[model samples]
Target chain A: MKLTKEDIQFIDTYLENSDVVFADIRMEIVDHVASDIEDRMSASNTTDFYNVFKDYMVQNKAQLLKDNRQFLKSADMKIWKAFLKGLVSPLTPLIFLTSFFGFYFLYLNFNIETFRLIISYVPLIGLSGFLLTYVVYHKAKNLKRFSVVERLAMPFWVFYQIPNIIFNFSYQAKNLATVLWIVGIVSLVLTLMLVLVCVSIKLFKSYEKQYKTLA
Target chain B: MSNSKLYKGSLTTIILKLLNENDKMYGYEITQRVKELTKGELKITEGALYPALHKLEAEGLLDVEVAKVDNRLRKYYKLTETGTKETVNKLEELAEYIKTMQALVNPKLA
Candidate 1:
């Protein structure tokens, strides 16, 4: 079947309904996929616009969807968020490493017991929390469903955490390190879950906004 | 035959009606169907078709499924129950709009 302006309009309608990337992407053409289908239905084949769209969808929607996904995967939010998440936390590991060495030296040469107290907790729980958040960040990046990179990084990026977790691990404060570790891990997980929640909220709000506009 | 303003208004309704008739539809074939049906009266623009389809999907008036066709992944859209009802309402509104226009222009028909 030859494509008409009305048919294009029908496809446009279909895209608007299904694939977000396709809908939000460029639409310089005034004629839509649905209109193409309409034109065809009114033409010689006697095939209704409904049947034609059905056939076309069955034949072409998969490819269109894949293209649509790729278009969305390359979406600015995904890339920008990923990059920003990666960018903002560049110093997390470094800070952790620095504290790790600094504490070790202090333990070797210095008689100061306070540094010992701090280093104990820093590695035990605080470091664990930071690492776990790092893990969550990586997981979020690998999975493209929702946005959850920066919040996970907040604990990891926080300058005081490295020393805090290490210092908490001492004999005098083992329990403190444990508590901090638990909180860090739980917070990281919560941050990840909240990312999904936030995306859901955005999607719902967007839907409501669009539905209202159409209504 | 081409580039008329009157055609644009019914575009969504036409898509909904077509989807109501058939279970689902994709991109290229929908375009082909239009050419075959219109007998060259209307030509759809790709730039326009994609964005509209997405909006309808987002609105929940349509349901989409991704299936493989001809070694390519295709996204198919079918009208929801609400979509079917809306299609009828929209068509009726369009008809009423036309009638109103006729009353204004050709009062004898009114």
Candidate 2:
């Protein structure tokens, strides 16, 4: 009583289409559904994989996806809150405040054009770095080998791209005053991206260690 | 199957206790084990089981490992050190709750 590769692929496709794109969640659903189907097939007279799988999916898929989404939503909130807690703590907050005021005063008094430009583009740089890392390191290099949790967390990186989209469409920072205003917002976004990356990397490392023992 | 609502509250305790007894178990194996142990009186639905397992892992009460079995990757869950500690507490708490419920429901038995 086991599922074939084709059966697994078919389940994967179904899950992807049904908004179960996160690999971590997808893998669980796959295992649960596949196991149940195998048990059913073994007990029954029929050996048809498709029919058995379809029957189970028709009965249980919606409930399974609903339960998973509910869990992921809460889990995502907890992870975000933990990262936010770190960022808002005494030391980190003081450091960020000092950096912000330092940058603001430098731009305010000296009016350096290059510094202003770089400040204005901090959000764009952060977003680009995220995109580049994801495309090169994550998608290209190790997507095939990534554990389920890693794949699930990939979609959350889209949050970093939001600031990039805002900057692209509405940005008109030609002067230091405009640069100062936009830079603050951009720097905030950049900090958030950094926090997200740190949390993701930490999570990936733990997940990798957990899976490595099985390998 | 028993009432899902009643069983829901105790699901985590049940899972932890099972993992405490066994070395490791995959999703299907866990469900089957529950069924066999309960003699078909309890059924762990896929909807309930997977979400509960994921939540437990997120809470650091369980750890997961994946291996290639029968040409497909099978993810197995085992209790972590913290999870082992938690199981004892949960079981004792559950035992207390059950005793209270028994007293209320069946005074003679209590």
Candidate 3:
């Protein structure tokens, strides 16, 4: 007892009206409800989609919606935890060390003004480039509206302001020690930004692969 | 049947064990399989089942694949390599727990 396209659409519309709006989540729920309805219809040897759907909803809608909310929260938490874990991963020290030496070299070779300009603009440029690439990838893949992708992008957007924050504080350093401290801090920030970019790319690639294969 | 709480704690193990036996399963299929296996003794609600599935997924213990079935897309879940390994450990843990409970609840059976 396969449901008609109209039956499927009816369930989709019902869910959307109930605020289960994310396509990824809605898609799964729609299938679940449709499957449930089909099973009931077959078992009863009747094809009353509306009555079966209504009964299923009466019994299950609240719980389904609750599960959807719980999933969203847990998904957000998992993404943040993964991002934070990536920040302190084994590769992080290497990135930090390289960034430290790189910043130290720039500070030594360039005048303070030039160093400040380079430090400020380099991360900004890098972040901007990453943002652009992320946007273009989503646009090309047509995955812009996925709730999971939006959650994954949240940390990157939050960390995107790190460069400007560092830039603002870079001006306050007066002595060599203070400058050294700033350099170390900037290197740390760079490492964080780099890790954020890597994690985002890894997660996005995994999802892109999943979606592509599924498609 | 009256001891859903007893089963609540074991849902993850149940899901992993099912996926371990079967290659992959969708949400509705998993529910139906459980129902059939239990002979109507245990029923997993959508609220409990999906959150559990998503949690396992977030933990990287499950991987999802979507296929268009009939008129719509259906999401299927399967155990990952880590998940497959974890399934064995979880089953062992569950076995131990059940033994302890049996010994406590029915010494003659133990």
Candidate 4:
């Protein structure tokens, strides 16, 4: 028994009301429930979608929603693991080295005060720009909210505030060694952020591909 | 059949073994397959099944592919290269475990 569009919409509405708000996770659950209801309707020789759905929910809703709550944590773990894996990938060191040398070159050529200001502000500016672009891109593409992709952006949010925290502390490098240390740390942070952005884009594209056929 | 705990430890292996045999399977299909293969003695619930799938996916052992089927999108899980290799290892480990349990449960059979 194939479910009608209205039947699917009912399931979607029910899940949303039940707090299954993330579209990616909700899509999977909707499919699972719809499939189960179809199987029941076929076996029982009944077309009463509501009765079948209600009965199924009575037996399964608690379990399903319980598992749903864990989705965010699962997504968080997956994102962090991906980020860590990205950090250790062979390309990371190359990116780090290249950025390190590039930053160090600028440091040598540019005035020290201007160099420090650029290093401090670049991550903040870059993070804001990335967020703006990400929001607009997703809106333009009409991509659904995915928990994994949302979690992937979390580290950048934390990184975005670091410059402000340092500014508040008014910490300044006093010597070449201190300046070099700051440069190295900034290079590493930039490399990590770049890797995270790459991972985020990869994840977004994967999800986009998964749902591309949807109307 | 009443003790889900007995099967809990082997859930990952069961999933891997199934994916090893079948090219790809979705959540509902995997559960139904388990019930069918076990002659209804083992039923994999959705609560238990999705988490396992997600964990294996996180571990880089399973790859997910989504496609439009019927009126909805179906998320199918398949064994990655690492997952394929790990399935063999898990199956071997499970066999050894069954052997140990068999020896303990029925000494003469050992």
Q: Whose lDDT is greatest here?
A: 4
Compared with the true structure, all predictions reach lDDT values of 0.51, 0.70, 0.81, 0.83
TM-score of chain A of each: 0.31, 0.64, 0.80, 0.85
Steric collisions counted per model: 83, 0, 0, 0
lDDT of 2 by residue, B2-26 (tens): 4468898999998999999999998
Q: Which of 1 and 3 is the better model by lDDT?
A: 3
Instruction: Please state the interface RMSD for every predicted structure, separated by commas.
Output: 12.3, 3.5, 2.3, 1.4
Off by over 4 Å in 2: A17-19, A74-78, A81-101, A104-122, A125-129, A144-192, A204-215
Between candidates 3 and 4, the one scoring higher on lDDT is 4
Candidate that beats the other on lDDT, 1 or 4, i.e. the better one: 4
Comparing 1 with 3 on TM-score, the higher-scoring candidate is 3
Q: What TM-score against the true fold does each predicted structure earn?
A: 0.41, 0.74, 0.85, 0.89
Poorly placed runs, candidate 3 (over 4 Å): A81-91, A109-130, A161-168, A213-215, B1-3
Candidate 3 displacement at residue B82 in angstroms:
2.4
lDDT tens readout by residue for model 1, B1-110: 13676777677776776787788987555655666678868755443454456556556678766543322234677888888888899889988998999999999998
User: Taking the tens digit of each residue's C-alpha lDDT, what string does model 1 give over A1-215?
Assistant: 44545545555556667743233331312123343444566665665666877865686566555555544433434333533444346454454345445555554465536645544454345435544544453354232222122333343344345444434444342354554443344334334333333343344343334323221
Chain B vs. true chain B: TM-score per candidate: 0.86, 0.95, 0.96, 0.96
lDDT of 2 at B91: 94
Q: Give me the candidate number with maximum DockQ.
A: 4
lDDT of 2 by residue, A1-215 (tens): 77788888898788879887666566667777777788899999667999998889788877877866665764565466556655775555554566567667766676456554555566555456545555554555454334333443453456556555646533465665676666566556666666665555565555556445322
